[model samples]
Target: MQATRMISGRAIPWGAKNIDTDIIIPAKWLKTVSRDGLGRGAFESVRAVPGNIFDVPANQGAPILLAGDNFGCGSSREHAAWAMLDMGLQAVIAPSFSDIFSGNAFKNGVLAVTLDEVHIARLMAVAADGAIITIDLENQVVTSDRQDRFAFAIDPFRKMCLMQGLDEIALTLAADDAISVHEARQAEDAPWLVPAQG
Candidate 1:
């Protein structure tokens, strides 16, 4: 996962509510476990419609998405987060999000920001005008070039993990030295319990 201290860029501004995992990436795209090419499948149904927000040229490769309340509301597929990352969305701004989706987003390094409805509306308007919106995870605030500022809250542990680019694998590897020490001690204390060294 990549470190994400701040994200400043164009936002998709799709303020529709109740966007589920299947809407983000349909089940047909779920056959493969690999995240490669999943971006092409992200919002597959929405993109199929004429002049969808995801198809707008200016919104291409936007790092931030502006969504309405109850975003990512259905299913617990980790692929939803994978698809967003694949599409280069480092953060999502919404009034609220599904608990499962929020967890998945955090684990995959996608910042799921929760703000009040008023902030969402303003951001959507700003996005519609093509203004840049910025999210500062370190400072826990979202800002716009037009002097819009909104603060948000996040778990300190999740913030640290995202800022440090620490995934589960990285977290485990951080204790490598300690693990080695423990194994050595166990072997010494109980030779029969330890496997023979190659």
Candidate 2:
């Protein structure tokens, strides 16, 4: 996981509501466990149209995505975030998001920003021209060339983990000393439970 303090780049506008995981990676593409090669499947359905925003060259490698309300809704598929990351998206902005998708995204190092509908609309407008958008996760603020600025709230623990690039296992490992102490106590309480050394 990479630490995401601030990101600046053109935002790929995907202003559609209820974009479930299926639409993100498609069900057929889920066969592979590897996160690689999933970018080709990202928004496959929407890209059929030749003029789709994502198909446009300017949006390629864009780090931010400006989406509609209720983005990333429906089934919890971690693949959705994986595909987006493979496509080089670092963050997504929307009015709201599915709780499961948001959690998965955060764990995968994707910043899911939830703002009001009005702010999302403004962002969509800026993204129309593939304008560069800046997100400061630590500061909890987003800014764009249109002079748009908005503040968002995030759980402190989640923020810390993202900033420090710590996943669940990493977080637990961070308490190695405490875990060692507890295991020593357990060994004293039940010596038989521990396997005897040969």
Candidate 3:
């Protein structure tokens, strides 16, 4: 996972509510075991429509997504996070989000920001005008070039993990010294429990 402290870029202002996992990447695209190429299938149904927001050239590769309430709802598919990452989205700002989806996004190194409806509407307006939005994870605030600023709350542990770029594997590895010490003590206390070497 990449460390991220600040994310600043134009945002895709797709304020449609209740966007589920199926709408994000679709089940048919889940056939692949790898995360790569999933972006091509992301929001396929919506993109099918002419002049959809996701298909807009200006919004292409935008690092931020401004969405409506109840975003990322429905089935818990980790693929949704992968698809977003592949699509070059690093953060999603919404009034609310599905608990499962939010967890998945965090584990995948994507920032899921929750703000009040008023702030969301402001962000949508700015995004519609193709203005840049900045998310400062360290400061827990989102700002726009037009002087709109809103503070958000995040779990401290999640914030720490993201700032340090520590995924589950990396977190476990961080305790390697303690684990080694415990194993050594166990070996000394119970030699019979130790596996025999070939």
Candidate 4:
């Protein structure tokens, strides 16, 4: 996972509430195990409509999405986060998020910012104006070119992992030396517990 200390770009003004995982990436797209190409399926249903916000010309390649309350509320599918990243969304701002989706997003290096409805409205307006918005994870704040600033809270551990680009596998590998030492100690303490040489 790439570290996400800062994200600066136009945001997609999608304030639709109660958007579930199936809506983010339909279940039909879940047949494959690979994360690649999921972007084509991201918001498949929404894009089917004429003149959807996501399909608007100005919203192309936006790195941030401004969503309404309770974003990412549905089945515990990590694909939702993957699809968003593949679609070039580095962060999502909303009034709230489903706990499972938030965890999955964090694991995949996607910044999910939670703010009050007032802040959401302000950001949504800024996004609709095609203004640049910035997410500074280092400072735990979101800012817009319109001089709007909103502070958000995140778990310290999750913040550290994202800033360091440390996924669970990276975190486990970082403790390799300690794990080796423990294994050696166990071998010395109980010979029978150690696997016999082939």
Q: Highest lDDT, which number?
A: 1
Clashes (backbone N, CA, C under 3 Å), per candidate, total: 0, 0, 0, 0
Give the higher-lDDT candidate: 1 or 3.
Answer: 1
What is candidate 3's lDDT per residue for 12-131, written digit by digit as tens?
A: 988889999899989998889887878888888998999999878999889999888888999888999999999899999999999999999998899999999888888998888988
lDDT of 1 at 192: 89
lDDT of each: 0.91, 0.87, 0.91, 0.91
Q: CA shift at 60, candidate 3, in angstroms? A: 1.4
Model 1 CA deviation exceeding 4 Å by range: 169-198
Model 2: residue 76 alpha-carbon error in angstroms? 1.7
lDDT of 3 at 47: 88
- C-alpha lDDT of candidate 1 relative to the true structure: 0.91
> Local error of candidate 4 at 168, Å?
2.0
What C-alpha lDDT does candidate 3 achieve relative to the native structure? 0.91
Q: Deviation in angstroms for 89 in model 2?
A: 1.2
TM-score of 3: 0.85
